[model samples]
Target: MPQPQPNLTRRGLFGNGLWAAVVAGITGLSAYLFGRTKQAKTVWQIDPDKCVACGNCATYCVLELSAVKCVQVYAMCGYCDLCTGYLDPDPKKLDTGAENELCPTGAIERVFVEDPYFEYNIKEELCIACGKCVKGCEAFGNGSLFLQVRHDRCLRCNECSIAAACPSQAFRRVPADDPYLLKGAKESKPAGESKGIA
Candidate 1:
């Protein structure tokens, strides 16, 4: 007659439980690790109000070409025919002529927006981040044009290199959900609204 083996043992139960626990733990850990790795990196951003358009953006960036670029606030623009930002700093003529334009790369495009108002558009492809257009606009225009870093070009380092070199200290971190702190149509006038930067 053959001897029957024991069906269940304390050792067998303990060993099976241990393996189950380990596998469950591993699965949980893998899910957590995968989620963390899939998340995007948060990075420093520019506050348009604090930016002085000092032309530092052109030289301070790590890349050969700066990630900063001038952006137009169409809603705030006067669209003047004789835009100081578009024309030469001291040009005898203030038209679309290349010689008279303030932008070194002719990145600013002017469109007629009825009498006494002209719509200015930025040609970002031509922009070199020199900030001449921003400077001119801030000084003479509505202070609408400003610079911001393109997230695609930004490395999102733990400590931003451009922030260190920025004279205005305009750089700040924002939540990943609300990446850009752009101005709304209605500007807030509350005294407490001045603290946060985009």
Candidate 2:
């Protein structure tokens, strides 16, 4: 009888190599497609125009400290010694009395930038997303104080929980390259007129 052909023949080597190459190629394509799809869906955004500043974002957020924060519009600020947003809604005087402050978290820091002009800054660490500052600014000042999503603290979920609970439906998905939807140049008209009014 003829000797059995060697199991490890030239045909076996060629077939095994071809199959390995094909498997690798398929895996590479699958990874590429998965990456592309993931990139397309990675969007996290907040619409300052529609935010009601109701303080829901502070508590409703999934993070321990709400990823949403109140930002300032320095130019629009009247720099009044008595900021309605910063001070108590019904204040006894324009003093730094906690009782007279509107911020539940006391996150807004008011500094005397100059005579008749004060610099208003947000202490993000202290901000609780109550929107008191935004409301105060919108009501009296130029509407400069607005709410934004802090990406570092933000989980960047596929569907943000805050967006779902948003009263005004101000949340949206934006391109990953430019995630933060800053107030545009033309759109910047002080805080009171910018957007996100009650």
Candidate 3:
């Protein structure tokens, strides 16, 4: 003997259709959100041209040690033996002694490259991002030294404290793929040339 089929109700059909619609809407929304999550994000970066070395990076960073550090533009560096950036203004002797160093933490290391040129390397571990070296380099020498945010150390906060405190408004949201704003990289002339001459 064959069994009879259950009755199909309009209410049940409408309820099922509504449930299907809700599921489809939820799925579509989830897909959209997932795709958005994969989209490229912008990270905070300093535009070297706009930066005024205001010393805010040291004071305003949320991290105990600021993510910002001094970087040398080697192409622009004059490589002088008596580097104003490396030595204090009034050093008793042009020596590599800690007392004579401009960096409070002695982060900048002067290495003999050749005859009169010396290569300055920054020890990031010791850097305080105080901008003292950067200021000195920009004012007296080739302006090779500049401050940049170390992405590895940066928290990438939604609202960067250092950025908020920057007086020059140098901080900007740059694409994460190319976040750094390097100095001397774009210039056609050597960085040692005086302004307007280049």
Candidate of highest lDDT: 3
Residue 178 displacement in candidate 2 (angstroms): 1.6
Off by over 4 Å in 1: 1-41, 184-198
List RMSD in Å for every model shown.
Answer: 7.3, 7.4, 8.0
Q: What lDDT tens digits, residue by residue, belong to model 3 across residues 66-139?
A: 99999988989999888989999999788899889999999999999899889999999999999999998988
Model 2 CA lDDT for position 139: 84
Query: In TM-score terms, which candidate is top?
Result: 3
Cα deviation at 82, candidate 3, in Å, is: 1.4
Q: In candidate 1, residue 148 scores what lDDT?
A: 77
Please provide TM-scores, in order, for all candidate models, with all chains considered together.
0.69, 0.72, 0.75
Model 2 clash pairs? Answer: 49-196, 88-100, 142-191, 142-192, 143-191, 143-192, 144-191
Q: Could you tell me the TM-score of candidate 3?
A: 0.75
Q: Residue 182 deviation, candidate 2, in Å?
A: 2.5
Scored against the true structure, residue 152 in model 3 reaches a CA lDDT of 94
Better of 1 and 2 by lDDT: 2
Residue ranges of candidate 2 with Cα displaced over 4 Å: 1-41, 184-198
TM-score of 2: 0.72
